[model samples]
Target: MGIHQMQSDLRAFARERDWEQFHSVKNLVMALSGEAGELSALLQWVEPGQIGAWIARPANREAASDEIADVLAYLLQVADGLDIDLEEAFTAKLAKNAAKYPVEKSRGVSTKYTELG
Candidate 1:
């Protein structure tokens, strides 16, 4: 489903459980961070070369997916709380990033855009 629909459904779900009070932007952001950390913890000790292989396992992949969903859920709540349009924000940010990191100077480089000039 689309972001709006998902946000609506999430709001409904939380409303049914009276969880809205707990979903203030600050709380949702903190929860998002926790969920992201959970996902990171799964790969924290894995060697970079083995990272892909480790996540390829069914159990690990499932766990990671769940953590990702948790992150998204909280993120959506945070956005909804702030009345932000995620898609628009993402498009604007991507456009700004592309301008900052144009291909000529950024190609084959990992340097920050500030340092690319």
Candidate 2:
């Protein structure tokens, strides 16, 4: 399902439990941060260049996916609480990033756009 549909499903699930009262934007953001940290923890012990292979293991992959889902769910809840359309914001942000980091100059560089010159 699309992200919007997933958001609706999550919202319905929350409503069914009267969980909305606990899902304020601040709380959701804090939850999102915690989930992100969980995801990061899964990779904390892996060597930088070997993280891809580490995450490729089936068990690790599932664990990582669960953490990622938690992060997304909390992010979606925060968006709903704030009345923000994530898809629209994502597209707009991508466009802004594209303008700031044109391919010709950014193709092989990790430097910020402000430092490109």
Candidate 3:
């Protein structure tokens, strides 16, 4: 259920299916993007308020979860391939975002960081 468990399961599934050979970082990244596109397509025409309901629909939720899993699987594979630590990357990104969007200038505002003055 945790990331480590999910990563192990994904690796095991790939090995069982002989898919590791085709799961290089580049290929996995491309597949991850494609899956993200599929997830995005599901909300393309839905209103903001309705999007939540659409996502909550059983079939839609299943599809969304599958796409999310695809993205996560590839991301973990990429980290494993490059020997990078996901926790470190996550922490670094959080710090970077914090610097980019200081609360004094960002709170209660929907504007982008670039527009904050």
TM-score winner? 1
Clash totals for all models, in order?
0, 0, 0
In model 2, the worst 10-residue window by lDDT is 75-84
Expressed as tens digits, the lDDT of each residue in 1-117 for candidate 3 is: 776777788889999999999988888778878878887887789899897888879999888888887777778877877778888899999999999899999999888888887
lDDT of the structure predicted as candidate 3: 0.84
Better of 1 and 3 by TM-score: 1
lDDT against true structure, model 1: 0.93
Checking candidate 3 for backbone clashes, the offending pairs are: none
lDDT of each model, Cα atoms only?
0.93, 0.92, 0.84
Model 2 Cα lDDT, one tens digit per residue, 45-103: 89989988987899999999999999999998888888899999999999999999999
Residue 96 Cα positional deviation in candidate 2, in Å, after optimal superposition: 0.4
- List runs of model 1 lying over 4 Å from the truth: none
**lDDT of model 2, residue 85:** 95
Clash total of candidate 1: 0
- Order by lDDT, highest first: 1, 2, 3
Clashing pairs in 2: none
